[model samples]
Target chain A: MRGAAQSLKYLLLAAALAYPLMPFRDVYVLHVLVLIMVYMVLAMGLNILPGFCGLLDLGFVGFYGIGAYTAGLLTIHYNMSFWLIVPLAVLNGALFGVLLGAPTLRLVGDYFAIVTFGFSELVVLFLTNEIWLTRGPLGIPGIAPISLDVTWLATLLGVDERWRYAFRGEVPYYYLAMVMVALVFLVMTRVEDSRLGRAWLAIREDPMAAASCGVNLFAYKVIAFAVSTGIGALAGAFLARWTLFISPDMFKFWESFLVLCMVVLGGLGNIRGALVGSAILIALGEVLRVALPKLGLPAETRFLAYGLIMVVIMRFRPHGLFTQVAESTMQSSLIKDLRARIAARRTA
Target chain B: MLEQQLVNGFTLGLIYALIAVGYTMVYGVIELINFAHGEIYMLGAFLTLSFISMGLPLPLAVLLAMLAAAAIGVLLDIIAYRPLREAPRLAALITAIGMSIFLQNLAMIIWGSRPMPFPKQALPAFFSEPALTFSDVTISWMQIIIYAVALLLMVGLNLIITRTRVGTAMRALAQNQTAASLMGINVNRVISFTFALGSAMGAMAGIMVSMYYNTMYPTMGYLAGVKAFAAAVLGGIGSVPGAMLGGVVLGIAETLGAGYVSSPYRDGVAYAVMILVIIFRPSGLLGRAVTEKA
Candidate 1:
């Protein structure tokens, strides 16, 4: 069963990688897939707070907005490459995360959540009102798409033509988004098994006990905030270039709630669940957007369904579709070797 | 100009106070921020509009709306929140947010998305007239009505909370739920009653605001709810009086800030205050210190 499941997973991945190259690939489907990947990154980033750390952050979209605006403004003003802009955006997001988290992490429970919500709202307000900076409500448009300028490498290799690849359609973004999702997923899973990850789990399960166990809750929480917000910014940077436009309204409170719903739906603390949740919810949203109008309901009422899904899930399956946390810890080669040693000792 | 802003701020503050009490009461009891409380206030306005249009007088319409809002609040608790009483606080909080979005969109569906004028024909002519005028401050009859109604309801709420057996049970529950349940206090019933009381006050505030502005919309609850929660947090999350005080302060600060600092960022003021207050003094002005437990 394990081998079959593993094979099926690889099969799905192989299919995804090949789909863009396939002749029958549709632009609309490709677009939706890329969008799903963007949200997948967001959900995974957000999952760190409520899922692993037991901290409900309602204002995560603030970081996403900051990252996008950082990328958007830097690209427009300085005419910088996406590669350099990503690091700058990520740094800006982590800086804001620390600035916000340092003082606010001491707030317990709902207070922390509300502060995050307020911070996000303020971010939107700033983006909307700071006309001199963010262009206010008009939003930045015509952002340059992600380009691969490897002319230096080409020069080193003695190539004649300048090596520059500009992304035109959704295909490049789809693959780029895939790479981003994979990278974030890898980081999250690795963190989920590391000492820092265990400390977070400790903090989540029992803060006082964790404190007694010599885990510095505040430092770890700040690290978690920086990492989570940094990933959120990474997604935002990708979005700014891919979408080619971003407005303050795009980062409203509703987007934060939507992403939170995705995190909860996929089962909190489970990285794979975040991916699945994003795909399902985004796909469901697309379906409802088209389907609702035919049924004489406004497309906006699809949120009614999203809201209902959350309520139902909370009442019925609060642990989400997946109930395990750190499921990969047991599957690590070190754990496998330990298991073998224990089995041999028992037989002896 | 300042006096006028103060009066305006005071009126707005009272309405916020009304909503804040609901959030504070629910939080005191369940330790969950009842995000749907704001929707109840929104429903209050919509229901009053619906009732007035159906030929009921304004007074009767407002009364009926409050009762209906109270009932809905109770149902919201029973249906959405009660099942997760023993679950983690996050579950209940998410459910509250879910219910909030559900009801807001449900309102949008029921009443079209556009802002509707509170039935003008249903209101008394005197409401729009000046009840008192002095210097640059002219208090409209509607403002006077808002003042009287909010004051009376808050006073009555204080009485219910301080001078009643149910109030004592509620206090007990806030202190410790398991102990209160063990001591024969019906936990769910008190929670429902708290919701009812808070929802009714919130509904009345909604009606008054819609009347003051002469318009109501579905999404009004989202921002108002946050601000009122801010008020509650400002006063102290679990204290009733704290919520009241917080509401007025926040309202005045908001109006004054809008008037003096910047008008376009009017909504940002409340958020800023809430964040500042939470960071500097999470205990708020009138409540106990919020410890990091559970």
Candidate 2:
């Protein structure tokens, strides 16, 4: 029965993947799908930090901006290869994550949040004002698109001449983005069940108790930060290659809030939640962007609707749509265990 | 020129300080960043415009704006914040951000996105005229009135906080919610009252800046709100006086940076200073160091 159910799930997944590439698929819809994939990559990264680790970071877009800018600069100035810039961007993100997280990890709760906010604001401000480096507010234009560099392999495999040239079309890029998204999604699921993830959840549940039980709180927290930022950086780099222009304005703190909203709205600490969350939010954005103008509503209504959605969701479902079960169990266990332990200690 | 910039900075900083106080106080009690506070300030400004345009006296308009904002603050807590008080702090934070976005876009819808010039003629002539003229630094009566009103309110707040029974209860609640409740303090009432007071101050700051600058807009709250929150953190998250000092410091720093370095970099300077302060002195200027209880 379990085998049959698992195969059923795989069949559904296969159908979902195949539907997008059907011959009748619209290019605009395809574009939206790719964008959703990009956001899924980002939200998956964020799933590790605030979802599992319980550290609320408001500066996520800062790391994203850094990755995009690094890619843009290297492509613009040094003419670096896309493959090379991807690793470089990831390493840069990890370095910056450590640099930022090392000192601020000790801050508890809201202060940590504010500091992260300040850091994002500072990054955007610097990016906007430093004309010499970032070209200031005008934004960097004519960014190079990614090349597959797979032509040699195709020719070696003796494919037909028509099928063996350099890659082209948004369709290929969509698959490329999907591959990365799948890789990130796989890594996130694995991490959620890994010992490192357990360590993170342990620190989140009770720092002092976790510490007494031999959890290296700062070390694990910092690692979460680095890994999370690295994933975001990877998304940003890939996204920059897809788009031909990059700008300081594109990386506003609002992007961070948007992704964070997805993580929470989907379900904090759930891997599957990240995928569901990003899809709904990104689709909502795309629909509103297209629909509001048709309905003669103001462009600003798009954002107003976003705000209303959040309020309504929080009012109706504070634990988030995807978090109905595990949330209660997790909370009850932690609080109940603590209270029980204290009671037993007093009785003893 | 330097003196003039300093004056400008103080005026800006005082307004930010008022908003910061709202952030600091609410944070002290509930530990949510209260992202909606800036929007409260924006509402206060817009409410003042509505009331004054309806032929109410300026003083009455300001008072009504404050009261309405205070009520809104209370409502915000009761609706968005109160239920999530015992839930994870992250839930509260997200709700606050949501509320802020809702309020901002609501403002934009209610009032068009364009900048509206405040009706300077509705004020007495004295308010429009110069209060005192110095070399290249003439201070207007409006500036003086703003300063005087802010000072008066701050002093009044200090007295209420330090001397009144309500203030004592508030401080106790801030220290320990359960302990204060155990001691017979009504935690709910204290939290509600704190929100009312903080939001009142923020509304007044919004009104004053609107009149002082002679312009208002829905989006004004975004940057001002961010700066004010930064001020609160820079001064120390939960410290009231620290909000004031942080506000003034940020104001002067931005003004001077704009005057000397580059005009566009003013906002950057404030954030840079904020990050440095958070990095170097997480305790803030006057705040006591926080130790993790867990």
- Clashes (N, CA, C under 3 Å) per candidate: 0, 0
Q: Under CAPRI classification, how is model 2 graded?
A: medium
Please report the candidate that would top lDDT against the real structure. Answer: 1
Q: The CA-based lDDT of model 1 is what?
A: 0.92
Report each candidate's C-alpha RMSD, comma-separated, in the order given: 3.4, 3.9
- Model 1 misplaced stretches (Cα beyond 4 Å): A324-348
The true-versus-predicted C-alpha distance at residue B147 of model 1, in Å, is 0.2
Best-performing candidate as measured by DockQ:
1
Model 1 docking tier (incorrect/acceptable/medium/high) = medium
Model 2 TM-score (B-chain only): 0.97
Instruction: Give model 2's DockQ, 2 decimals.
Output: 0.62
Error in Å for residue A121 of model 1? 0.4
Clashing pairs in 1: none
What are the per-model DockQ values? 0.77, 0.62
TM-score to native of every candidate shown = 0.96, 0.92
